[model samples]
Target chain A: MSLQVSKNGDVVVIEVDGQLIVGNRQELKQRVLDEAEGGARKILIDFARAGYIDSSGLGVLVSLAKRMRELGGDLRLANLNDDLQTLFELTKLDSLFQIADTRERALESF
Target chain B: MHAALDIRVPSDVQQIEAIVAQVVRRCREHRFDGRQLSLNVPVALTEALSNAILRGNGDAAGKCVRVRAEVTEMRLVLEVEDEGAGFDLEACTEDPTTPENLEREDGRGLFLMRSLMDRVERFRGDGNVVRLTLNRR
Candidate 1:
């Protein structure tokens, strides 16, 4: 998977393309942590083009969310497809993440 | 009729992509559509394969993970074996959904494999072998 980062005022939006699974979960984690370390308080992960995400992917997101909160930053998700949403719901992660329907809303959330 | 695919790879995390891609492609060829094609097939196969590489084989350089898949009209069956000590599925006790365990990253693969696939079985006569079965319908 490839991640592209862009800034929208104080919020940094990371657009992820391709699959987020065990093989590439570290890349996403590192990229997001880098942004957090760089002092981005509000982060948005745009999953518009993400085709697949496994348990490892979910674990990565959970770790990111926890780390961001510890650093006084936050991470939000946007553009989750049905399957992605279902996975979150089934795993009870839907409550842990602040999900937005669009990038604009996610950016506006913080 | 059954169409089979076989793969053997060193116990490396990098090899997971190719195996997952092949599983997705073959399942698609077997006419899995919609959510089954996109989420169920890829996610389950990836988790199973990742377990074999990372946990089962311990990422040993010379060790290998063997994967065999049989795709048919009724079901898709996959077997993943690793050249390491058997994995103790009973040892995994963390509940991924709980508030405390939600932030932990180490124990969710088995939960997902069981959740996404129709059946997940572990055998240890020769080596650690995990068999995953998913219904096409």
Candidate 2:
């Protein structure tokens, strides 16, 4: 998977492509931490290109959300696919994280 | 008659889902009715493989997880074996419905697997082996 980070004022947008599963968990986690440490509290993760997300991938998101919350910031998701959305809903993570339909919406949410 | 495939890869969590996808496609081609199964085998299998790759191997090179899939009586059975020291399944708290635990992350894989598969069993006595079975309904 490839991750791209862009900053728009106080909101940091992360675009993730390909699959988010066990293998890329660490990389994803580290990147989010870097963003948080760099002083970007509100993060918008774009999963429009993400095809699949497994449990480990969910774990990465949860961990990052916790980290961001502890730092007094927040993490939000955008462009989640139906399958991915089902996984999130089944795991009840849908209620835990703020999900938006577009990058602009997510950015506005923060 | 039944066919089987055995794959062994280093404990790299990144590669787990891809492999699971490959296996699921093959299983589907063999006429496995994935929809009838409670848990999408592809997703559940990926979760098992991820656990083996990430938590079991712990980023150690050379440590590997072995996966095998077989069909019997139109049912699919998947076995994931890891070389790492086994964990206590009973000790793992996997309640996904708990609000406090909901957003914390990192413990939902096992829960999802259990929820999706018809059968989920862990052999923690020796090497870690997670067995998942789904009947083509």
Candidate 1 structure quality by residue, lDDT tens digits, B1-137: 14388778888888887887788788888798778888888888888888888878886788888888998878899898887788667676567888877768667788888888898888884679999899997
Superposed Cα RMSD, model 1: 1.8
lDDT of each: 0.85, 0.79
**How many clashing residue pairs appear in each of the predictions shown?**
0, 4
Put down candidate 2 lDDT per residue, B84-132, tens digits, no spaces. 7867776776597688778666678888887778898788634789888
Where does model 1 sit among the CAPRI classes? medium
* Residue range A1-110, candidate 2, lDDT tens digits: 89988898888888899877766767888888988888889989999888677777888898888889899999999998777778888888888889998888888888
Name the DockQ score for candidate 1: 0.77
Q: Positional deviation of A63 in candidate 1, in angstroms?
A: 1.0
Provide the TM-score, chain A, model 2.
0.96
lDDT of 2 at B125: 30
TM-score of each: 0.94, 0.82
